[model samples]
Target: MEDEIITDGKYRYIEIGEGKPIIILHGLMGGLSNFQGVTHFFPTKGYQVLVPELPIYDMPMLKTTVKNFAKFLEEFIAHKGLKDVILLGNSLGGHIGLLHTKLFPEKIKALVITGSSGLYESAMGDGYPKRGDYEFIKKKAQDVFYDPKVATKEIVDEVFATVNDRMKLVKTLAIAKSAIRHNMAKDLPNMQTPTCIIWGKQDNVTPPNVAEEFHELLPDSELFWIDKCGHAPMMEHPEQFNQILDAWLVKRGF
Candidate 1:
């Protein structure tokens, strides 16, 4: 996926297949590779899957907010000349997609969120004060999934590096704070975009109730559950995730 990323000016992304666009948004500590199953499976199903490298740490400190990330997604969509896109995001990425759709609903056809963090602040995780502790970071990373082994060495190492870097750490915290500040509870009722909420039943980060709240608040939404899955349903249960989303898309005629 890294080699396939197209670097167009400041924007870097991976575009696969050809048909209706399904732009993927990665989480706060997640990379484009987290969606390997999604990027691979969707294209064959006749959807153009795109995973953009969100500038989680590239923006100026003051501008590093969830709102700005949503705006950046808007800019990326325009740059690619894409419209009627179906946004599929996890964790912080899901929050950004929700905000983007609220701000610019005209271009989006549907929304899919898993382990998203719009209504819960704890979803961002407590501050990483033990940035120097490898074991601590490793445990934190492993806790993201129901099966601890899913947090591969590469994934833990990437998380370790991000927290250890001073600039990235500050930006990460800034984004977390921004996410808390930009809660979408008040805005969800008004946003009429159809949504697919696939949640990990065992998701401790966002918790199961968060998905229920989202479904209850949103005007048009359907919720699906994956047992024994956590935070990232697409990663832990990619097959189930794809099946649910695919069926939902077909049912919605998207």
Candidate 2:
């Protein structure tokens, strides 16, 4: 069965211009609105952008898992009749994109991952302090930003406004914990799709070293580094991010 499309609902998105399809997934604690400016930027550059909010939220009925998240994206593609989709994601969303590519490699035309997670330096013996379970959940939200000022109460409040269930935070933290423990890097080498990995040179959350490892494992992938940015470069440096993305698409003729 193809994916069903629902409109006039809370799940926000815009279909603009018209060319090859490009779907974007947001990181943890983000809604589709996290990409407000992006929809226009891509469409005018000559592509379609589908920015869908993940189905799971505060609803006790909703189950958000890597497996199910991929299923939702599959449905989304089918419902919209999108072909030649260039899938992209950041952080936890990037992990989801990798999983989706593994599941439906043929549906994806290409992949772009930014400061993605799932590679932690646990076994490296870097002598870094290991975060306890409680500490991980309560991990310094401030540290994810290149500038700690971005962690201001207003920004935190805006993010929390979209997070329906506070308990979901526990689940997300645990999911991230498992990614580093279980490892998602194994799926990339088998991937034949054109892949690009973008990183913030100053990213502290995932660290620049994680990008190096991803580049090492995914030998067929392209890596780009952006300076004067942090974890959420898309939001922090929208122009530069969009420019590079546009260039990547141009190379592919999307």
| Per-candidate total of colliding backbone pairs | 0, 0
The per-residue C-alpha lDDT of model 2 at residue 53 equals 72
lDDT of each residue in 1-254, candidate 2, tens digit only? 22233463445455556887888888775555555566668888778777777754432423446666777788778778777889888877787788888898778988888877666522111322233332322234445567666555655564454333456555655454545654667876777778788888988777889888888777568788888777776766677888888887788666
lDDT of 1 by residue, 21-100 (tens): 99999999998888888899999999999999999999999999999999999999999999999999999999999999
Off by over 4 Å in 1: 1-3, 124-127
Task: Identify the runs in model 2 with alpha carbons over 4 angstroms from their true place.
Answer: 1-12, 58-63, 121-141, 149-154, 159-166
- The model with the greatest lDDT is 1
Give the local distance difference test score of model 2: 0.68
Instruction: Give all candidates' CA lDDT scores.
Output: 0.93, 0.68
**lDDT, residue 57, candidate 1:** 91
Model 2: how far is 175 from its true place, Å? 3.2
> Candidates' TM-scores?
0.98, 0.80
Q: State residue 23's C-alpha deviation in candidate 2, in Å.
A: 0.7
